[model samples]
Target chain A: MKNNTTLLRVITYVVLISTTSILINDIQEFNFEQFKSFASWSKSVNKNENWFTSKNAIMWSYYIIITALFFWRGYLIYGFTHFVSILKEIEKENYFSQKNINYFKKIGNVFITYTINVLVLQFLLSVIQGASFNFFKELKNEFTFLIPCGLAFYLLAEIFKRAKTLKEENDLTI
Target chain B: MPITVNLDVMLIKRKMKSKELAQKIGITTANLSILKSGKAKAIRFSTLEAICEALECQPSDILEYKP
Candidate 1:
């Protein structure tokens, strides 16, 4: 599973970098007047103007790549939770094997740290994009949604930490 | 790092099959097999006590110093 995750991370990075390069090229050659006309056409057809504005199809490619990145992040979180559960089961059997315990602890720490980093990055991006679009009302709404979601994620990490500690204590008791 | 379980001896002396003992102990047959094979990581104290009481034996009788 760890190997599989590493492979996925590598794939995600490759795709993101490639798509970002294409996006840069598109931005450099964009014709604002032509783009405005295209945007109006897109609006009339109820489609996303940004999706069709790029010459290299970077906009559509970026949409797909970013969605994949988010899904990968979700998969990582799921893997971490599964690992925590496995550790809990092992601990229940009073198996205090130090090496195994340390391995799990390290994984948990990494998961928590990465989760925080991702959330911060997401919040910053949301704020920057919203402000640029002058969408203050939408920004406020997003903040309301983000706060609870962030808290829930934090709470889950806390629960996993407490469970790990309790399992350690149980092992020591025996 | 080695420990010994005397579950088999207790069951044999009590004229009980592993399945019967497992049923009375309220654990699955698979877990009973784990205990019998000495492959179990650990056993709960409550479970140990129950096993001893049910088989009319002592903890020392069910678990031995394996060195």
Candidate 2:
């Protein structure tokens, strides 16, 4: 158990660190310069001042949608932290504790939420930028695997709940 | 929940303390308390056999099915 827990902890740490650093790298690479076009358009439209007629609305929307995507990536990373909490419960011999069950459900919620929101935002951004958005191609991305994994975590939580009741009954049985 | 344990009655008849019975049967006092208090869901055959041996009573004496 110790060996397995240690190995799992290491793997989780590596995943969290790599993901977070990758996100930070993307944020650094994000171009505020893209919004520069919106600036000249902003001045040009000052007489009319209608955002709809602004020449750079698409670029602005693209930046906004991409930034939202980055935040959702951060949200997904937050979900991964719950795995550490679940591992902590296991460390204390509380494999079926309510806290662990809640953590599992929470992770499932986060994974599904992040995936669905990211997909929607990506689609919307593509529509704004006049890019072709392929649903199956997006599904083939590595992150899409989290959907099944999220469902699996919810299943684990339900199974743990049943096991907890059985364990309590067994403990009281003499 | 309908099935109740009458371990306390058997313990009294056998003139044995709960702690003593728990010791003889190789179970903790807390668990024996759970059984005596009718909080236990089920009893294992090995534990039931040990309890019967310790109390010199039948399983029916220590367990009752009340409607």
Candidate 3:
């Protein structure tokens, strides 16, 4: 059991590191300089120009949506940190501990929230770019799996809650 | 809980210590404490039988329905 937990811990660490580096790389590739310039432009631009239809307005909205998407991605990565915590609990022989259950619920919330928020951001991005948004086409993407995965985590939390109760009952039976 | 344990009362009647009864019944003193404190959710039939056999008392003597 210790070996299995160690192996799982290693795998989780690898996944966490890889995803974190990828997110960092993506952030580096994103044009923060352009966002800064946009901010400067907004400060000096013609105040009389229509706010909704101007090119600068569209650019600002685009940057805002991209930033929000990045934020949600970071949040999803934060959710992955809970796996390490859960493994630590298991290593301590606390299988149905309240901490682990709460971690599962939090992961579920993060997963569902990240997915939904990203989808909305994508639709908004498409709209800002004057592209048609296809909802079904978006759902066909890989991250859509997070929806069901989130629900599974919620179910796991509920199961752990039940198991905790049963364990307590068993312990007190005598 | 609706059901209450009267194990301490039965122990007094039988002039038995909690540790001695736990030893006789092959259960830990901690578990006996749980039973005595009415903290146990449910008692197993085998354990109830062992306690009865050790105390030489009826099951009703150790368990009571309060509500």
Candidate 4:
């Protein structure tokens, strides 16, 4: 069990560092010049003009969507941190603790929500960039596995809950 | 949980301390407390037989339904 926890800990750190570096790299590559172009638009422009057709509006929306993607990645990192909490509980010999169960449920929520939100944001960004958005291709992306992983965690939480109940009953049988 | 545990009542009638009964039954005082507090979900027949043998009483003396 200790060996497994050590391996999990290493994996969690690797994932955390990798995602953080990716997000940082993305931010560095983001075009700040788009803001300059947005600002260069005349103040006297017609109010009736379609906002979606404007280059500045597309760039601005793309930036916001990309920022949202960054935030979702951070949320995914936060989910991974719960593994530490679970390991701590196991270290204390509390295998079926309520805290562990809650942490499992929370991780499930974070994984599914982060993946779904990132997918939507990416689709929105594609629209802003005038690129074709393919739902099936998006579904085939690596992060899509997070959905099933999230549900598996949710199932684990429920199993732990049942185990907790059984432990309580066994303890009181005397 | 709806089934009330009357182990405390049986202990009072038999003049036996909770710790002593827990010791005889080979269970912790804390687990006996859970049973006394009616927080236990279920009890094994073996444990019930042991309690009955130790206390010289029937299972009815230790467990009861109120509702």
Candidate 5:
């Protein structure tokens, strides 16, 4: 299990590095023509007409990145807090204290929040990519894809809520 | 769910105050209170052993089966 975890960590870093490299490449190759096409496409949609402009698109990307980073940090904070608590509980040899159960709930909450943020970003990226290429035919496809993401978010929230309730009961008993 | 704790009886027999027992056992009064009130979900064997040694009693003196 330890070896598998290390391998997973390595794979995650590799993926992150590759993704950052690709994003840098895309930013370097960015051109005014793409912006013009995107702006024109935005004008077609009443909801995001202003967002199609070059400046607005850049601002939108920044906003998305900021929101994503904030939530990502929140997820990390909750994850680390829960992890430390679990370690402390284990150190105290209090397995029946249900502290780890509370930590599991925290992990679930973080996972759900992070998953929702990623899903929203993916939806926005799909819409932006389709609009830039004038792919109106695939517009409905993006909205439909969000349904499962929403369901998964709801399921995770419910699971965490149940776990939290159990933890509370355990705490009360103690 | 209906387990019984005889912490109070043992403390009384030893003529030891809860606060003093807590201090001697390196645990907080709050935790000692929880144990005395039979609300503790679990207790570490080491903690149980320490309490028994400090009070010079057996586990049966501090814990009992009620259900």
Candidate 6:
């Protein structure tokens, strides 16, 4: 069991490090020049053109939506860090500890929040690109698994809470 | 929470030290302290029996219900 936990910890660390590096790389590769041009464009506005319908406005909206998606992805990664915290608790033989329960709940919150925000951003991106947004089609996409996964984490948290209570009762039994 | 332990009172009546009773009852001194302080959630029947045998008391002497 200890070996299994050690292996799991190693795997988690590897995934976390890789994901962080990838996110950082993506952020670095993002077009800050377009944002700068958008700022300049706002200063030299074409008075006759509708602001919302302009090409620059659509491009700026696209960048903003992309940035928001990246932020949510980073938040999701932060949520994964809680798994390491939980594993540390388990290693100390605190499987049903309050900290573990809280971490599980936190992970659930992050997952659901990330999924919802990403969905909203995707819808906005479609709108900016003059494309139709189908909510059901979007839900059928890659990130949809996170919704049920988040719920499962919540269920796990509740189970851990019950186990913690049972453990306390057992310990206090004399 | 209304249920209180009276183990200390019983111990005083029998003139037995808490540690000695714990040893006689085959429980840790720490656990005996939990019982004495009423921090234990529940007591096993076997442990109560052992305590009763060692302290020469009834369960009612060690446990009490207060309104």
Worst 10 residues of 3 chain A by lDDT: A49-58
Count of backbone clashes for each model?
0, 0, 0, 0, 0, 0
TM-score of the second chain, cand. 5: 0.93
True contacts preserved, each candidate? 0.00, 0.95, 0.95, 0.70, 0.25, 1.00
Model 4 C-alpha lDDT per residue in residues A1-174, reported as the tens digit of each score:
888778877887787788778878877987767656556664555678876666757667877786677667778878888887888888778999999999999999998998889888988988887899999999999999999999999999999999998887776555
Q: Give the candidates in order of lDDT, highest first.
A: 3, 6, 2, 4, 5, 1
Off by over 4 Å in 6: A24-60
Candidate 5, A22-124: lDDT as tens digits:
5556557645464565567567657735546786676568456544643454444444355455545655655435456556556655555655565566556
Write down the RMSD of candidate 1 (Cα, Å): 14.6
Sort by TM-score, best first: 3, 2, 6, 4, 5, 1
DockQ, all models: 0.04, 0.79, 0.90, 0.60, 0.23, 0.94
Report lDDT per candidate.
0.58, 0.86, 0.91, 0.84, 0.63, 0.89
lDDT of 1 by residue, A98-167 (tens): 4344445544554555454445545455543453433444446422453454455556556656776677
Q: How many clashing pairs does model 5 include? A: 0
lDDT computed for candidate 3: 0.91
Worst 10 residues of 2 chain A by lDDT: A48-57
- Docking quality tier of candidate 6? high
Candidate 1's docking class is incorrect
Q: Which pairs, if any, clash in model 3?
A: none
| Tens digits of lDDT, candidate 3, A1-174 | 999999999999998999899898988887778678777887888889777767867787888888888767789889999999999999999999999999999999999998898899999999988899999999999999999999999999999999999999888777
- TM-score winner, 1 or 2: 2
Which parts of model 1 are misplaced by more than 4 Å? A1-34, A37-141, A144-148, A157-174, B1-3, B12-15, B38-46, B65-67
Per-residue lDDT, model 5, residue A102, is: 57
Q: Write the per-residue lDDT of candidate 6 for residues A1-174, one digit (tens) a residue.
A: 899899989999998999799889989887778678667877888888776776866777788887787777789899989989988998998889999999999999998998998999999999987899999999998888989999999999999999999999999999
lDDT of 1: 0.58
Model 5: residues >4 Å from true position, as ranges?
Answer: A1-140, A162-174
Worst 10 residues of 1 chain A by lDDT: A60-69
Question: Candidates 2 and 5: which is better by DockQ?
Answer: 2
Give the Å error, residue B44, model 1: 4.3
